[model samples]
Target: MYVYDEFDRAFLAERVAEFRDQVARRLSGALSEDEFKPLRLMNGVYLQLHAYMLRVAIPYGTLSSDQLRRLAYVARTYDRGYGHFTTRQNIQFNWIKLEDLPDAMAALAEVGVHGIQTSGNCIRNVTTDQWAGATPQEFDDPRIWAEILRQYSTLHPEFTYLPRKFKIAITAAPKDRAATKVHDVGLRLHRNEAGELGFEVLVGGGLGRTPFVGKSVRAFLPARHLLSYIEAIMRVYNQYGRRDNIYKARIKILVHEIGAEAFAKAVEAEWEAIRDGALHLSDEIIADIRSRFLYPDFQPRADQPAALATALEDPAFAAWHRNSVHPHKVPGHAIVTVSLKAIGAPPGDATADQMEVVAALADDFGWREIRVGHEQNLCLPNVAQEDLPAIWRRLEAAGLATPNVNHISDIIACPGLDYCALANARAIPVAQEIAKRFADLERSRTIGRLHVNISGCINACGHHHVGHIGILGVEKNGQEFYQITLGGRADEHAQLGTLLGPAVSYEQVPGLIEDVVDTYIELRAGPDELFIDTVARLGVEPFKERVYAAH
Candidate 1:
């Protein structure tokens, strides 16, 4: 967690003051809805179906105990006693009143969090691996560069109003937990053949009406040249990216129109012009940023043996340990994922009390730090293995200990017609229905590593494009119908899913999904073969045939 410096605090104060004035003007009728649209959007406020939705950025998905408490307070006092964690590693308060937004902003600023650049057609939140510093296989902490990009892109005059919204993600681990391949710009930190740390840059990766796995623009870029190289990419996009149609405005469209080679050439020409500019980070600046991300004090202990012993005796704890707990870089420590996907609950909704409970747990056992995963789960990143049982008990009491990480029940779904104005059908209920269908923990585990993602529309906010089994809500004739996709994955071998078949009525979704799952189970070589691996091996035809057979 990078603490805000004086410059950062001062900047936030001024920005909040400016937003407060704007919000007051809008409420007082000094500015009409048309006039206030962009202004409110710049502050991460959206006029949703029923009320205003305030999206607060959790930069790179990191949160301190104090910040988590403040968020819980916001959920308690301002909105409906809960907030929805989103796929972009942000949180949304759906019942925000137009007038109370400034107060909410002030409270967020008090905790060094804000909603700036969260909603606009500008550089949005810079995200990275949730286990950035703690992942053992990482080349370096990708958050260092993610934070650097945040500082550089925030309110940058050159990129404040891009042709369309841009998203950037970085990942240092060999496994792409950050979904880097589906971002506008993806940076993979790696050691080159020369054993020097640098980046493998990918551009034009995005999902919407058009989905693309971004192309490799730079095979290797030196670490020090990150900012300058990114600037070059932005310059190319800003100058040539379409402005006539919103559909064609994203950098991905530009890259698609002009081939990847030409796009890379354009970026290279721009990079050559500004390679030695002020944006290049010096050794001292890089070291200072790296120093801010100090590793937590981890005690040396032999607790894993005890943990294993406990797991052997208790099936309940064993199930949780198997699904929710992840290996940490430090021995005798683990990363415990606090699942938000309890049965019948909206995928990412966490009540204020639950948030507080998580905050307290983090304070007591997790180095007072928390992380929001891209899968809409909270993580206690530095929990000692010796303390897993105690932490699991508390989380279990709080209803946060759902042992369904990567299970079929651990679904990712967006606030569809329930909250989002752009949605066509209900996503939450579909997710809820499916979750209840697979609520049997034993059954879900037996199914093995199935990811179900739902989005109300083509915006793909739920990241449905990358799920092993993706459900997309759409309007067909006058009825709500759901479309399914298979084999999509967001990892080192990222690929968009193939559509299974025709859209099925909402009532048919759960059964249809079961059919697909049954097909996978029957076709799979063994129980150990994941749904994705089975789909990859057999292709989508078998699943599609079974899902559409009755229809």
Candidate 2:
């Protein structure tokens, strides 16, 4: 993890002091709720239903062991003894007292973490593929660029109050695990034909009441121009972004209203104006930032191949092999995703003790590195392949071993009624019930790599709009109802889901999901075809016809 510099330190200190004053004023009734709302939000404080929710930025999902320990301390001391990791590679504490928030903020600042840019109309946390540094296919570590953006965007005076909140995600992996297409701005990093690293810039992608998969504004943006290009985009948004209606506030709405070609032209015009500004990334600056991300030492390992062969024999290890593990960049190293979706537990709630265990696992197993994936899972990037069984056993004992990484049961759901004041229904219970319905490993694995996202409301916090099969909870006659949609995805070929049928009762949700899955099982070309691919090829007709079938 990159350590904070004097600049970063000073900025955070000043911002914390500023927020301390804001909190004091709000408490003293000097500022009305409406006035305090935006100010508090800019500082990453939210007035939730039960208590103030504080969302701390975990940039690009990279956390040092020390940072993890501090997070555990926050959970233990201030809030409850746990914290919730969110879908966009951030964490939220649901139980924060206003009185203790200042102390919490100071503690967080001590560890180079903060609530700034975690919420509000400025650019939120710069997220990336959890596997960035350790992945084999990456052109370069996207986290480097993400950090650059973090410094540039945090409390940026110009974009402090944009028309709406902005989000940016970068990924260098061939696989689109970060769902770059569904962000306000998405950067897919890759090397060009000449082997020069660059980015594919997409703008205006987001999901709310309306959803759009952003269009490509620049196909090949060299790394040095990253901040310059981003500045260009932000300037265009600030200048022309709509403030007439909150619903149309997002840049996605702006991108839709103005075609991609015209938007690109506008951004290009702005890019030309400030191409060589102070924000322009120079080689010396890049080298300094890049130095902080130096790879860990790896001793030559002659013992790895045989160890991996030994791991294949254990059934439990084999189960993990088929699920939560991936190939790593190092010779004897393997990528491991520590599944947080254990049965009956919240998807990403790691106990303080468990957090410590993860820290230990990262330290003892490989480099002192850890990654918080966008899918609410943790990634151990360079574990020795030979120790797979032992690691799996330890994770199992710690309740961190659930072999359902990309399988159907590994659903991504929002905190919903459990945490959010904006939610209309309880997504956790519904998700839990659906998990129960598909608990059979054989059945789930047979279905394969399906993303089922559930949102409690149309705000789409759970990203249901991008799931292969999406579920949105709504209130009908004061009763909770769920609307199912099919064919949605957030990869390069991103598309919002189309509704399947009328909203179903909460009681009938599991059955409806079963019907949809069953229909996919019947109509899919083969077991190899995942739900999204099959749905795209076959359309939603089969699933819809079966789900809403007249009995």
lDDT of each: 0.91, 0.86
- Model 2, span 1-551: residue lDDT tens: 67777877777788888888988998999989899898888878898889999999899899887788888899989998998899878888999898788888888888788988888788889999988888888878888999889878877999988898999999888888788999999999998999988899999899989898989999999889999999999999999999999998899988899899999999999999888888788999998888877577876665457867787788877888879888777777789999878866777788888888888887788577788987788888888877777778788889898898977778889998878889988898888888888888888888888988999999998899988889999998899999889989877688999888889888999888888888888888988988898888988887777778842
Could you list the CA RMSD of all candidates, in the order they appear? 1.1, 1.7
For residues 1-551, write the lDDT of model 1, one tens digit per residue. 77778887787888999999998898899999999999989989999999999999999999999999999999999999999999899999999898888898899898899999998889999988888888788999888999899889999999999999999999998899999999999999999899989999999999888989999999999999999999999999999999999989999899999999999999999999899889889999998887877568988967586766765478888889888888888888888899999999999999999999999998899888999988999999898888888898899999999898889989999999999999988999999999999999879978999999999998889889999999898998868998899999988899999999888889999999988988888999999999999999989998877768856
- Residue ranges of candidate 1 with Cα displaced over 4 Å: 303-308
Identify the candidate with maximal lDDT. 1
